[model samples]
Target: MTNFTLSDLESIVATRAAASRDESYTARLKEKGVAHVAKKLGEESVETIIALVSEDEERVISESADMLYHLLVALHLKNIPVASVLTELARRTSMTGLAEKASRTPQASGGRQED
Candidate 1:
């Protein structure tokens, strides 16, 4: 038996994502399907941003944790790994922020304004 590690939260997220519905919140989120998971992520992100704008470090940290947790759940729902996101981030790390912003078109996913 290879006893490596669930040392990383990504591993934890993966396991939780794959487990039976009763076994974990992340798993439950997966069972509920993509739209539900996406809604939860959106809610958490909004909470985190609200905390940030209020300049409350404690709430910011707390909500940010919730945000990341739900994001992992969303990723699991979509079969996308955290590393994929991190890799894209790594690829963009050297690019000028303004240039990156300009490089993105308004029609990209998540860029549409609410009705």
Candidate 2:
């Protein structure tokens, strides 16, 4: 039970996303479907990048939170449970990073990485 696993974040986001239209911003965004959620994620990601490059620690933390929240929203709209994703991650953990990289055959990890 890690305090801040990605699964925990997913649960929080999914719960908030299910709220009524006026209940929470997450709910409102969820109501707009995956496209809107993805748009928000993109915006937050840019904010995080800015924070990483030129902002203070607090700003980086804040923007990272925002990015994570929007990402969860997107994932929720797609009906993907955190547990399902974690299962995949757990599987990946069994392999070495380099081995995992090489194991993802040509067509899988983005078309062979252009040699």
Q: TM-scores, in order shown?
A: 0.77, 0.81
- What's model 1's TM-score? 0.77
Would you give me the overall lDDT of model 2?
0.83
Q: Write the per-residue lDDT of candidate 2 for residues 1-115, one digit (tens) a residue.
A: 5478777888778778777878888888877889988988999999999999999999999999989878777878888776777787887789987777777887777675643
lDDT of each: 0.78, 0.83
Off by over 4 Å in 2: 1-5, 112-115
Q: TM-score for model 2?
A: 0.81
Error of 1 at 109 (Å): 6.6
Alpha carbon deviation, residue 95, candidate 2 (Å): 2.3
Per-prediction RMSD in angstroms? 5.4, 2.7
Clashing pairs in 2: none
Identify the leading candidate in terms of TM-score. 2
Can you write out model 1's per-residue Cα lDDT over 19-110, one digit (the tens) per residue? 88887888787778889988988999999888989867988989988888887777766778877888888777779866666666778536
